[model samples]
Target: MPALTAPAKRLHAAWLASHAEWGPGLHEDGFGLLPEDDVESPAGFEAWLERLAADSARCTYRWITEGELVLGGIALRHEGNNSVDRAGHIGYGIRPSARGRGLGTWALGQMVEEARRDGMDRVLLVCAVGNFASAATIERQGGVRERCRNSGADKVWRYWISLGQPAEGD
Candidate 1:
């Protein structure tokens, strides 16, 4: 597996498709939440990148890959994001074609490791209430479900994973 890298031109097709599929909301990876409008075109995406690259941005963004093929992305927020409450410190997603494999779980572990390195004792993750796959991924990483809360129009299950503990399946 290759190390995390900044979003680049090569990932356009997959990134766009991921955005299209996700539809109408922020694609939260450890970096800051990406507004749907921000990625509508090459120029917009570049502008978004410019904003994220700013030192004042509170999040770190990275895309996971295997060689030149992008697998997924993760974002780690250094500052508390007001959108999903203070607990939702990380967010990630795999492309549609990459789902069902263990990539989500793997990527999440890597993200948690990043958090631990940054001195976080625990981190919060949330998935749509019906998204059992994501809940399972979080659970595999030692996530303990806290509760389901309504956020905007959707209800999400919140989980907390302690960095010092080992995951149940990994």
Candidate 2:
């Protein structure tokens, strides 16, 4: 895993090639792996990467790669504001061909470790009710469900994972 920096341009391109539907959950100028618009030109891609590197206030996007092959991406938000309310602190995805190999679990564990390193003793994770795989991954990482609620068209499960000593709300 590595931070999305200038050198990760090739990795970004590879990810975009394999994960075409990545734009759906991504926000404009947010810390996701990609943006809503298609980066057609090389210059446009570079510009997007530059903007991603520059945006540190929102969240941090990390590429989960092995060698030069980009497998997936994970994000850790800096605050619990905005869409973070339902999305929670971390969001991640694996490439189509890379699923079912336990990479998602590993990446999520890494994100939790990253959160602990960043001083977040406990972190919240919310997953869509229909996404049973994600919920299982979170549970495998010791996440305990706090509640469930209907959000928009889907029901979401809110979970809390203690990174260190139990926090006030944990």
Candidate 3:
């Protein structure tokens, strides 16, 4: 394991400061682990975080932070999309402050590496049809928009990222 270097630490600080909405997270584990310690109940978010922290089937990590602010994060679902189409197994979100900077694409890109490291056949990502940013990000990541369908009321676009395969980066 590698310790968080100074540059990475700087990015984390920028991230936290940028997303003060999640201010308390900065104090958790001192690296934005979502310190929900204030909550005593073991059935709500506190429990959820605890479970999330302990789970091995899935992992959530900050791809990069622009300070304490989270530029975005990457989550890996070990189940690897149970649906027939191999829906994406990763989820991500860029801090509002970091939006429009291509961070989502970069975040997701790093997630692909994470998926490979976690041993996956591929990743399937679903994006809202109207979310041009997501669409753009997916495209840049070599996500072939397989199809679009209605999910209750909103339209969704499905993308595929083959595992054990070199991504656009490789």
Best by lDDT: 1
lDDT of 2 by residue, 103-125 (tens): 87898888898788788878788
Instruction: Assess every candidate by TM-score.
Output: 0.79, 0.80, 0.64
Model 2 poorest ten-residue lDDT run = 27-36
Which pairs clash (backbone N, Cα, C closer than 3 Å) in model 1? 29-75, 30-74, 30-75, 30-76, 31-75, 31-76
Once fitted onto the true fold, the runs of candidate 3 whose alpha carbons sit more than 4 angstroms away are 1-48, 59-63, 80-87, 166-170
- Score residue 9 of candidate 1 by CA lDDT: 70
Q: Write the per-residue lDDT of candidate 1 for residues 126-147, one digit (tens) a residue.
A: 8889889989999999999998
Q: Which stretches of candidate 2 lie over 4 Å from their true place?
A: 1-7, 21-36, 165-170
Q: What does the lDDT read for residue 31 in candidate 3?
A: 24
Ranking by TM-score: 2, 1, 3
Residue 22 alpha-carbon offset, candidate 3, angstroms = 9.6
User: What's the candidate order when arranged by decreasing lDDT?
Assistant: 1, 2, 3
